[model samples]
Target chain A: MKNHFRLGLFIFITPVLLWLLLLIIVPHVELLLMSLHGKDDMGRTVWTLANYRNFFTEEIYWYTFVRTALYAVIVTILTFLVTFPVAFYITKIVSPRLSGFLTVLLLMPFWVSELVRVYGWMILLRESGVINHLLTSAGLLDAPVEMLYNDITMLMGLVYTSMLFMVVPLISSLEGMDDSLIEAAHDLGASPMTIFYRIIIPYAAPGITSGSIVVFMLALGNYLTPKLMGGKNSLWFTEQIYNEFIASFNWNQGAAFGFLLLALSSLIIWAGLKISKQQLGKALS
Target chain B: MAPVLDIQHLRKTFGDFIAVDTLNFQVEDGSFFSILGPSGCGKTTLLRMIAGFQQPTEGKLLIRGRDMSRVPPNRRPVNLVFQNLALFPMMNVRENIAFGLKRQGVGAPEISRRVDSLLERVHLSGYGNKDISQLSGGQKQRVAIARSLVLEPSLLLLDEPLGALDLKLREQMKIELKKLQADVGTTFMYITHDQSEALVMSDRVAVMHNGRFEQIDTPRNLYSNPATRFVAGFVGETNILPVRASSSAPLQVQTSFGLMLRATPVGNCQSDTLDLFIRPESIILTPAESHEDINLFPLTVQNILFDGSNTKLLATVGQSDHELLVALPQNQQFAHIGKGDTVPAGVHVDSCRCYPRGGS
Candidate 1:
C-alpha cells in the first residue's frame, strides 16, 4: 500500500518537475552564463566581468535603473493606499452579495490581454485622447494639454494595472480578521484612527507585504505600459533591457540587467519583510 | 444610590424582524447583573445596545443620569470583554493592558503604574512582558478584563467571556470572574446563554426569551419561582406537564394523564390550558401519610442516572407515557432505588408553579 502511494505521488509530481527543470531552471542557467560572459577580440564569447561593469560605468543605464525602481516603489505605495480602503469596504462594510459583485468588477480588467489594456490607457491619455477632448470642450482648458509620456502617466498606468494583485491579498487578510476585535478596540476606548493603526493595520501586515512585493516587481519589470504611455521620455529599466537584447543585439548586457533587476527586487522584498516583522513564507501564503 | 445604567424601552429592529423588543431595566452600581438566554433570544442585541455598539430604534439610554443616545462606543463610559477575549495579537500583556490608558493620554509613568497594579489585581503580576499568544486561556481572559477595567468605565459589559474555555476551566473562571468583579467593584452587565454561569456569578439574572425578559430576580428566586413557562423550562431542569383547568378548585389543573394536580398560580393565569412545572429535586419519594398538603402519586422507575452528587431517577407517573424526572437524595434510605421499582412520590402544592400556556 505504501509503495502504491509513493508511486502515485511520483506520477503526480513528475510533470511539474520536468516543466520547472526545462522551462525555468534551464533558461535562468543560460541567462546566468550569458550574463557573466563577453565578446573577445577574435569575436568569440569568453568569460568576463565587462558586461556587469558596463552598467555601473554608463550613467544613463544606472540612472534609468534607479528611476524604474523608484517609480515602482511609488506605484506600490499608491496602490496600497488606494486598495486598502477598497478591500476593507468590500470585506467589512458591504454585504456578501455586494462584495462579490465588487470583486467581479475588479477582475473584469484582467479579461483583456495586458497589451490591449496598455493600449486602452494610451487612447485615453494621449494629447488628442478622450480626456483632453473633454477638458478642452468643457472650457476647463484653452488648448489640449499633454497628459501622456510623463512620470505621472507611467505611474498611473502602473497602479491601474497592478491594482487587483494588491486588493486580493488585502481582502483575504482583512476577511480573516474577526469583527469582534474592532468592537473590542472601540470598547476599550480606542478612537477610529487608533483602531485602524493599532488593530487593522497590524492584522493586515502580511497581506500588505505580499501585495507590495507583487506590485513592485510587476511595475519594475513592466515593458509595454511604460513604452506606450511614457513615450520618448520614459527610460524605464525594462526598456533599456529591451534595447540591449532586441534593438541593439547586446544579449550579454541585457542578461546582466535582468540579474540586477532580480537582485534589486529581492533586496527590497527582504527589507520590507524585515521592517514589517513578517516571515516571507507567511506573507506569501 | 442611583443606578449606573438605565435602559428605557429600548428596541432594535431590522426591517420587519425585531431583534430587541422594548427592553427596560436598570443596572445598580457595583452589582453583577446577567442577561441569560439561549442563542437568538436577543440578549446579545440588548448587550450591544448597552455597550453603544448598536443604536436602539426607539427609547432612551441614560448613563449616570446623562442621556446617551448620541454617544458612540469609544466616547461612552463603557467597555466590553468580548466573548473570545479579543486581545491584540501584536501587543504584549503590558501593552494590551495599557492600551486604553495610553489612548486617554495618560502620562507614561501613570500608565505603567496602573497597568502594573491591574496585572497584580488579576494575578498576572510577572506576566507583563509575555506575548499575548504565550498566555493560557484564563490568563488572557484576565488581561482582557484588566484592559477594560483600567479605563475606569462606569459600566463593564462582559459578553459570555468564559464561553471559549473548556468545562473545567469554565467552572474555575466562574468563581474567578465573580471575585474579580468584587475586587474591581465596577458595575458589571454580563450576558450569557449558560444558566449555571449566570447562577454562579450574577447577583441578579434576567431570563430573556423572544426579545423580552421572562423574569428578572435573584438566582434562588428564579430557580424556585419562574414567572412563565419559558423561564421554568429554561432556567433549570424541570418536568413540564400540559394540563387543563379542573372544576374541583380554582387552582387545580387536570393533567393529560388523567391525574388531577394543584399548584400555586403565577400572575393572573386565567387561561383554561396551563403548564405545571415541578422541579426534579422538589419531588419527594415515600412521603409521610400525615402530609395532607402534599400531592402523592405512584411512579414506576424506568432508569436510574447515577451522577456523583446529581443522581436522578427517570420514572413515569401512573400508566402515562409522559416521563417525570425525580432527583434522588444522597442518603442511605434511597440507595437501593433502581429501575423497575414502583415507589410513591410526593410534591407539595406550593413547590409546583402553574402558568398559562403560550404566555411569554
Candidate 2:
C-alpha cells in the first residue's frame, strides 16, 4: 500500500514539478537576470539599475504604462457590466435546455484563435469595411465613417475578447446559488433593488472579483487587439516593451518593463482583494 | 379583528395540471396553522400563494383584510422560512437577521436592538458574529427562523424548515419552534410533509392530498377522527381494513378476513362497503368487559416488532392471512407476550373510524 501510494504520488506530481521548474521559474529567473544587466559607458555588460530608472525618468514610458492600466481597468468594468446580466439570465432566467444552448453559443466564438477574432472585428469596423460601407449605401451616412483606430474601438475589442472568461465564472457562481434565497429575501420585505444589491450581488461577489482580475490581466497583457484596432494613438505599454527588444534591440529594457508589469499587476490584484475582502485562496477554489 | 390570512376560492393551475385546486382557508391571528401533505400534493403551491411568491390563477387571497392578488412578494406582509433554511451565506448571523429590518428603513440602533433580542429569544445571543457556515444544522435552523421572525410580519411561513435536520435534531427543533411561536405571538403558517412535525407543533393542520385538503382540524381530531380515507392513511400508522357493516345502531362492521369488528362510520356511509381505519395503539389486547356492541377476535402472534416505546405486535387475524398491527403496551403485565402467542385482541367500537369505500 505504501509503495502504491508513492507510485501514485510520483505519477501525479512529477509533471507539475517539472512544469513549474522548467516553464515558469526558469524563464522568470533568466528574465530577472536579463533585466538587471545593462551596457555601461565602455560598452561592457554591467550590473546596473539604469533600465529600471529610465522607466521612472521618461515621460512617454510611464504615461503609456498608466494609459494601458487605465484602459485595462475600464475594459474589465465594461466586461463585467455587459456579461453579468447574460450570466444571470443563462443561470437563473432561461430554461435548462436553452441555458445549455446559450452556453454553447457563447463558446462558439472562442473556437477560433484570438488573433482571427480580433481581425474579424477589424474587417467589420474599418473605414471601408462592412459596417461603414453599409452605413454609406443605406443613407445613414454621406460618406464612410472612420470607426476603427480609437480608444472606444480598442476597448470594445478587449471587452469582447475577455467576455467569456468573465461570463463562465459568473455563470458557475450563479448556478450554485439557490433560487429560494432570492424568494426568501423578497418574502422578508426586501424590494427588488434591495434584493439585487444585498442578496444577488453579495452571493456573486467572488465570481465577480475573480472574473474582473482575469479580465484586467488579459486586457493589460493584450498586444493584438490594441495594436490592430488602435492606430497611432494606441500607446499601450506592451508595445514599449516589444519595441525595446525588437525595434531598439534593447533586451534589458524590455525585460525590466516585463518584470515591472508583473509586479504592478500583482500589487493591484492584492489591493483589490483587500478592498473586496476576498481571499485569492478561497476564490480559486 | 380579521384573521391574519384568508384565502377564498384560490386556484392555481400550470398548463393542464392543477397544482392547487381552489384552496380556501383562514389562518387565525396568533395561531399555528400547518398544511400537511405528501410530496407533490400542492401544499407548497398553497404556501407560495400565501407568501405572495406565486399568484393564484383564480380567486381572492386576502392578508389582514387586504386583497393581495396584485401584490408582489416583497410588498406582502408575510415572510417565509425556506426548506433549505436560505440564510444568506455571505453575511454573518447579525447581518442576516438585520436584513429585513434594514430594508424597512429601520435605524441601525433599532435594528441591532431588535436583532439582539430576537437572537436571545432563539437562544443564539452570542452567535451573532458567527458566519452561517460556522453554525451547525440546528443552529442554522434557529438562525433561519430568527431571520424571518425578527421582521415580525403579520404571518410567518415555514416550508418544512425541519426537513433537513437529523431525526433527533428534528424532534428537538419541533418543540423549540412550537415554543418560539407561542412566545412571539405571531401567526405561523408552516407546511411540512412530516405528519409528526405538523401534529406536534401546529395548532391546526390541513391534511392535503393531490391538490385539495382532505381534512383540516386539530391534530387530535385529525388522528382520531379523520374526515377522509387519505387523511386517515396519511396522518399516522393505522390498520386499514376493507370491511362491511353488519349493524345500524351501534355501527359494527365485519372484515373480509372472517373477523368481526365494531367501528363508527365517519361521514355519510350510505353504502354497506366501508374502509375502516383503526389506530395501532387503540387495538386492546384482551378486553376485560363483555359488551354486546364490541366485537372480539382471536389473533395469533405472527411476529413481535420491538421498537422501544413503540413496540408493535404483528398478528394474523383468526388464522387468516390478514395482518393487524397492534401497539404492544410496554409493561410487566404484557412482557410475557412474545412471538407465536395467541392473544385475545379487540378495538373499541368508537376508536374505529370508517369512511365510504373509494371516497376521498
Query: Interface RMSD for candidate number 2?
Result: 0.9
Best of the candidates, DockQ: 2
Worst 10 residues of 2 chain B by lDDT: B289-298
- Candidate 1 positional error at B56, Å: 1.6
Q: Over 4 Å off in model 1, which ranges?
A: A1-26, A40-47, A135-143, B248-250
Q: Give one digit per residue, the lDDT tens place, for model 2 in A79-128.
A: 99999999999999999999999999999999999999998998899888
Residue B140, candidate 2: C-alpha displacement in angstroms:
0.6
Residues B1-360, candidate 1, lDDT per residue (tens digit)?
668998899899989999888988898999999999999999988888888888899998999988999989988998889988889888899999998888889999999999999999999999999999999988999999999999998999999999999999999999999998898899899999999999999999999998999889999999987877888899989999888887534488889998888778886677778888899999999987738678888999999888978999899987888899999887767988878889988999998788788865
Docking tier of model 1: it is medium
Best by TM-score: 2
Colliding pairs, model 1: none
* Cα RMSD, each candidate: 2.4, 1.9
Candidate 2 residue A90 C-alpha distance from true site, Å: 0.7
Clash list (residue pairs), candidate 2:
none
Please give me the DockQ of candidate 1 compared with the native complex. Answer: 0.78
